[model samples]
Target: MTTYLNSLDYARYLDETDELRHFRAEFLVPERDGQPLTYLCGNSLGLQPRRARQALERELMSWQQRGVEGWFEGDAPWLSYHRSCQEPLARLVGARPAEVCPMNNLTVNLHLMLTTFYRPTGTRTKILTLAGDFPSDQYALETHVRSRGLDPAEVLVEVPLRAGEFHWREADLLQVLDQQADTLALVVMSGLHYYNGQVLPMQALAQKARALGIPVGFDLAHAVGNVPLHLHHWDVDFAVWCSYKYLNAGPGGVAGLFVHEKHHKAQAPRLAGWWGYDEARRFEMTQGFVPMPGAAGWQLSTPAILPLAVHRAALGLFEEAGGMERLREKSLRLTGYLEFLLQDINQRYGAPITLMTPPRAEERGCQLSWLVRAEGKVLFDYLGQRGIVGDWREPNCIRLAPAPLYNTFEEVWRVGEALDTFYAASRPRYPF
Candidate 1:
């Protein structure tokens, strides 16, 4: 309900009074021509935490100084290295520590969850998902269906957006779930749409699926740190996420998985590995795999210590910032300011752009996706040339997400200023 102004002074005033403003210094912002860039692409790849380097160095020292003993002798032992990330991750995604584990990348975890949950018994063989989902999730569903001797065309039930709409409606999505409930064995979807930045109604969807006896999961790559979640209360069966995006865990860093406590004791089929065996008896090199009781049982290999160090350091910042509740408050204001500026620009320049992200604060996170009416690429490039960093998707979408941890209100104002300059200059040439 705060009124936003287009002036730089107002932006600076907001930043000065901001409670989480100190967090901006914790990250290493990207620069162009020796000056800091107006970085607003955390949804694509987060800014590097200043502590990440030191965290990696600590792990390197453990290896250099302890050699073989490093596994047992360090302050944080290598054997339980992945355990360091569990609690913080749980807090971020809303689950118990035992329900979450840092492991392989996003797709690998997705396949594993699908394998365990997609028990398509006779007649109930379909997997419900969002149409135009991130390609990785789509591909994972397709190949997993094929591996199970089912036709993806028949087994994958996709809920499409209504014609000419940029996002899905909750009622429409729930209606499809109700219609397909009889045949659905699983409902796996993105917690937030990557392209349009819409936060789907996860709680409602999960409640409906549980009522219908269909197991549900989420690919929370875009939602994990960007939005608030309560997976346990929602009764989500399982979920997967990558830390490289909003987590700021460096590129290709260790990813995470969650399995609700209810499923921890289920006699489900899993693709097991040595690391997933009972920690107490793991070194026994036994004949059978006695998996760990919780989500940790999903692990596949020796923990990647270096990447985990970086992840631990990055997750620590969230804990220090008082978790997602505090961050979400700031994100609401940051994105709201950007929306206000864009609306002002559209009105002044004859509506040259349209916002694809939902206008309601509860329906989105930090991102605002704009659909440029003309020369989207040119406008995207113009922003880049001015040292403003945002990402462009094909056709006409440009996504700008200001991380509450590092981005300032003044930075959001600069984006508005730059866009105004571009559209004002283009008005004469493009007849806007």
Candidate 2:
């Protein structure tokens, strides 16, 4: 068991933390009156980087000064604007620049990728995914299957985890793949499970699906910036992620897609949009479609420069912070501290607040999902009333994501202390 230090002492420890002290100033943390609230909910929506506003303002200024000419004349040329974002985004996902493109939102990218990859025919008509995928992913898969005249119940295979288990075992996942190999058309899972913060074994799952000739894709919304990923090296057929979560790219920011280079020459059918046309002849008012090579071919319409600008500004912070490796190191330590504090609270109250996130540091991200046996909502409200911010996910789980870039260890300690007080004063609202 980890020892819990006093909250006041933990605040002093934050003052001593070299990394902690430097990053807080970079973000525009929310405040009530003059005091900064202890913000730990970066998993949902990240605090804006101080530079994000400036970067966006620059784009607005360029639009005002040049109008359409801004695409070519601005300090950051708008025509090749997305090109500047490609390298850093590629670095984040460990993909070649040609293989990655920041375009559309998460669900839209999923549908586009599905149009290219989820080709169900012959015996391989089933789609396999986790039982508790994010709602958006589940909806995307269901619509895709239904559109193909296949019943979602029959064609969608949701591999269930063991009873009482918080995470799905890799071996169990592989077994499902093997059992359904003959009929499985696509195997899609989140790189990190959203509710529990479980980091799935992407490489292993991708390899197993490949052996069975099944295309594997990932919804990396929660994982891309939270964990270090090598999507291309892992031989994943395709993947999509939103930039707003750990990437801190702002609300409804432009999303990203990865298409392995091997698919570049294949005459795979896609849901085509005009913006995806070959740029060289795009202005020629071409009669026939000539798709751009690589991931750029997935573009559906002209890119949203505003959201992309926000993304560009946000990504600059990530590059300056020395990329995912350093950020992930801080994440592991910060989340570990949160887990430590929660366990201390559990000990004091004899509460059955079990952590749903994986115990191994490598098997999860910064977010920790705690299952409060009683009064979960009341506790959630209490935390919200105080300065500490976290989120509740239905009946029992309260997800607390101590983002590596901005959250302090002292903040984690204070949340633990606050929860302990709330639980002690309140009676159980629901018995589980």
Candidate 3:
């Protein structure tokens, strides 16, 4: 059982005994008022790993010393540099190394994945997704459908939420897939819901789509490093994600994709670039295209070396924490703690802060998006003024993600304390 506590000493004690406590020093935390800022915004942008600078410097020196020769010569050659990051990246998402590759940014990867999977034919022309998915994804699907000379209004099926509901009911989604089975070309599943931080049922959703002969893909931007995912075992057709958020790869770092091994051999309809050509004779100045085997074949151009370097530095820490399973174990506890504290405040002050994220631990990640019953931004701005950095989504949700990789129990306690202070000051004047 979790020890419910409202004291700072209790929070510190939990931190004192935490096995992952030492890993905190590995990240560069932001500060305010001459103190470490209580940063719970990993869902928006993750804190940088300390080793990222050293990793960048190493590559910068190699570039300075070797110039173009850096591609073929050096301890870490740039030509096959993307190869080194495969294992850690694969481990994070639960895929074989052959199934994953670091490539373009999030929306770009989403478009690439759709280029092959979102093939619309005679009757089966629509792409199915939830109503409030990240806007970029909605836009990607919109443009992708438009590119085929097909009308997006007819091809894109966004299921609306139930009456007064904040969460998407899986039953409602499954029914839409079944109802539109004949016309649905693809199902785009978000591994984690971005706004509310709810982790969707990916495996079950894949099974549903597969039963109806509809191919499914995932935009795992929020799910990649924040939650445990098994894309291969779930038989996920294709998936894409950005590394900058929970993976802590810095801003606009390299993203990755997973192509099920089954689709590797002449199956995917790739928009081929020279980088995606077969590695054996890539530099032959060849005219005909021979795609590289497996997920690496999706590469469109030479990678941005600095971002890949920074990503590897971040992955190194995940490996040190003994992979995602261990990190997830701690994540469950930290997020749960935040939920508990928020609930406690909800009852104490009679403040109607309803958690927008899923109630079940299995259905959520580190983030807890709370819907303030009234005047939400007031509480959000209050927290920010107190050096607690959380994200504010419009219409009333404040998202606080106490990332297990760097966030501690004590920081979580301070959030609760800050809320209490906010309530104490604002309750009477604001007429809550």
TM-score (all chains, Cα) for each model: 0.99, 0.96, 0.98
C-alpha RMSD for every candidate: 0.7, 2.0, 1.1
Off by over 4 Å in 2: 1-7, 424-432
lDDT score for residue 386 of model 1: 89
Per-residue lDDT over 1-432 for candidate 2, one digit per residue giving the tens place of the 0 to 100 score? 335465768655754764646777889999987889988887899888888888888999999999999977967878768888889988999999989999999999999888889888889889889998999999999998888888999999998889999999999999999999999989998999999999999999999998888999999999988999998899999999999888888999999999999998897889888888887678788687889888998888989998899899888878988899998887877788888778877777675589999999989999999887876787788898888888889988999998878877778778877877876665364222
Q: CA shift at 16, candidate 1, in angstroms?
A: 0.6
How many steric clashes between backbone atoms does each model show? 0, 0, 0
Top candidate on TM-score is 1
Better of 2 and 3 by lDDT: 3
| lDDT (C-alpha, whole model) for all candidates | 0.94, 0.87, 0.90
- Which tens-of-lDDT digit does each residue in 18-39 have in candidate 1? 9999999999998877899999
Model 3 weakest lDDT span, ten residues long: 423-432
Best by lDDT: 1
* Stretches of candidate 3 exceeding 4 Å from the true structure: 430-432
